[model samples]
Target chain A: MTDVPSYLSPTGQEIVFLLLGVVAVGAALLVVTTRQLVHAALWLVVCLGALAGCYLVLTAEFVAWVQVLIYVGAVVVLLLFGIMLTRAPIGRAADLDSRNRPVAAVVATATAIVLVTVVIDGFRTAYAPLEPGGGSAREIGSSVFRTWVLPFEVLSVLLLAALVGAIVLSRTDIRGRR
Target chain B: MHVVYPAVVSALLFSIGVYGVLARRNTILVLMSVELMLNAVNLNLVVFDVWLRDRLHSGQVLTLFVIVIAAAEVGLGLAIILALYRNRATVDLDRLRALAEFPVPSPEDADDHLPENATEETAGQASRASAATGPTRPPGRDDTPEATP
Candidate 1:
């Protein structure tokens, strides 16, 4: 029912996914390596936004929007607040990284190799053609409310507990100071 | 087009996260790395869920749960880190050995790194301690941490 681009069918979508993937991975790398804490958080925003784009490409519109709203909006903001409250080295932390760079790089590379190999091999033959309502909000809502209601309620409780725990832990004077 | 496409990307993202957690000393950086890893898992879950075409969309639902758990983890983790920094002056994981029961053994006490008389003094103490304390390792002697005047 769409008339955007006949040639844009698979080739165009693949190119978009590839571009978003590149952005996501590069930003994720920055989030880890940047000495400045604020910059690292900003890079994480880029990475998370790009992943939301990937979800869009995968035809999971509901998930894509939720990713943007929750991850990019709420989570990153909370992290930034945490950084500011903790007096993070926003300018330059010369000692932000330790002497384990070489070891960690080796471990990360090996894990990447193993994960890529296994996932690619296992899903080589699998494919999912796009459908109009395959992953729309209506569909996701149905699944969530019917088959996954209990876990959803549990998650709400977990969030509430986290909120209270954070308040209790961060307060300097538990009883007196305002 | 292929399911492996997003899966591979997620793997690479997870690897970057692993490196961040291992190499970065700042507790905040470590927390951010964990978020990255969780995002990677979310990507894979949604991709597979769509690929399998499960009517329940279990993968996406689970991703939702993971997102909540990540939020909770960050909240607690940052609070702990803040409390730790307030108690101590630093957040360096290597430098913060507070959890260790006994003080870490430093070569500074042994003086083995010293130029001359290194072995003579340490060995003398070693023999003396073996004689006094039986076959087990001897307590610190001349250069003993508690021996300082």
Candidate 2:
């Protein structure tokens, strides 16, 4: 068989992935540690954008676009609106509740360790190379509409519920009427 | 491209998101951090899904679902924040300590105490402070003169 194209080779992909991964991580760190709320939100956008890049690198074009359309586009806009409406303190709070830092750190660390171990072990034990024709958007469309129909419908209902819950929580006259 | 590298990148993004959620205190910022984590997860799912490249296309479909949910989450989150702002002048999470079981403040009385000046002043102060403090200004607040210092 002829050799795979150099551009499509695993090595090339790895380099791209490495660069994007570093960007994603650095952005994420900024998102969490930054003192300013708006800054954190902006950093989150960077992190999410980097994630979209990762998906693109993986050749999951559909997922990458969805990530942008949903998380970056819709969710982040909502977050910014929340900040604006609530008038969250512009400056970092003098003391932003450091009481739970130790506990949160311990739990997060443990979770990370366990997750990393499981993922690594899984990769090592079940390393199945993907077929060349895999990851096409057309195939994904069919699968979502066909096999995953039930879950898809359920998800719609769940979204409806969330919408209703949001409305109820935001209603100004709930207690007033009673 | 090889899926491993993207997976690693996704992991790093996820870890940083975790750190943000843990460290940040502003509710809006915290929510933003959650979005970051979600994006990271979305990257991992898409990367692996692409690699699998089976007829199933499991990852792409799941990513769609995540997007939908994230949209709904933000809509609701913003509403809650608005209500909270009405009840309490500040959206600082520290000040919302008793949100769960606490009595909602009466709007009639609450509106009178709303921090019109406080927010304006803080915004102004943060801008001036950033210039005065150093070139490294914190993230969210606009450092403009209009904001009362």
Candidate 3:
């Protein structure tokens, strides 16, 4: 505890993480506020990609790659397909926001203030020096199979359930039995 | 790295997600907001995993699980949304108030909700409220006619 580094003189990792954090937060803000539907999804890509970078900086290399593959690659493409299928306007339209924008803004601001205050107060002196290889693919894979195997298997079942549910929901001919 | 930086960033991202979910009118946009919130949680998990150096690396493993769940959620959500659009021909959250507490009033009841001396201002207010509730007609009754054609 006494050996924690001072924040006044940050290290290189801290600098890179802060820059990535700024990009993530900004892109996330843009994702929510953008009027153009397509643009919002694009901004989400930037945001998620930045988050992956943050994960990398934090030394979770496996999680970083998984984040990029699942979120930035697959999820964004699905959202884009959804946008097109729904015939959302190609360009910006005025009604992207609902009537309670001000209320939402207030609530979100309050949430941020409370969360940031609590985190900073609690973790003011806490520091964790990054070490490579802890989150390497081999380490995480072995851990998944060895320690978290049950949950991992359960998650696969959940994925299969979701796949079937989606198919059933989307296909008009799949009527439920009376 | 100071733990505060990632924690603070994740907090802000979650708040932005809260705002998007509350304020966005499109269902898909709301889904994107949900993803943002999930990613924020993932960041927190990864940060803690790195910090704690747990023997099992539970935090990172859980992060991977969360990502998988998020993918499944997006798939199901998009399917539901597509189904909605097919039947309703629109995906605006504001317009999809079928289950709102205030059921849309009947033709006769519409007059009762408004005063006899209703001005344009009052009429607008009344209509807006009604629109928010939407018509509570039998679901199949509305779409069936169109679907058969």
DockQ each? 0.34, 0.29, 0.64
> Which residue pairs in candidate 3 collide?
none
The per-residue C-alpha lDDT of model 3 at residue B51 equals 83
> Which candidate would rank higher by DockQ, 2 or 3?
3
Q: What ranges in model 1 sit over 4 Å off?
A: A1-10, A175-178, B100-149
- Whole-model Cα lDDT of every candidate shown, in order: 0.78, 0.64, 0.87
TM-score of chain A of 3: 0.98
Fnat of each candidate? 0.71, 0.62, 0.92
- In angstroms, give how far residue B146 of model 1 lies from its true place: 26
> Positional deviation of A115 in candidate 3, in angstroms?
0.3
Worst 10 residues of 3 chain B by lDDT: B140-149
Give chain A TM for each model in order. 0.87, 0.81, 0.98
lDDT of 2 at B46: 71
Candidate 2 CAPRI level: acceptable
Which is better, 1 or 2, measured by lDDT?
Answer: 1
| TM-score versus the correct structure, for each prediction | 0.80, 0.72, 0.88
Q: What are the per-residue Cα lDDT tens digits for candidate 3 across A1-178?
A: 5688888898999999999999999999999999899999999999999999999999899999999999989999999999999888899788899889999999999999999999999998888888899999999999999999999999999999999999988888765453
Candidate 3: Cα lDDT at B34: 100
Residues forming the 10-long window of minimal summed lDDT in candidate 3 chain A: A169-178
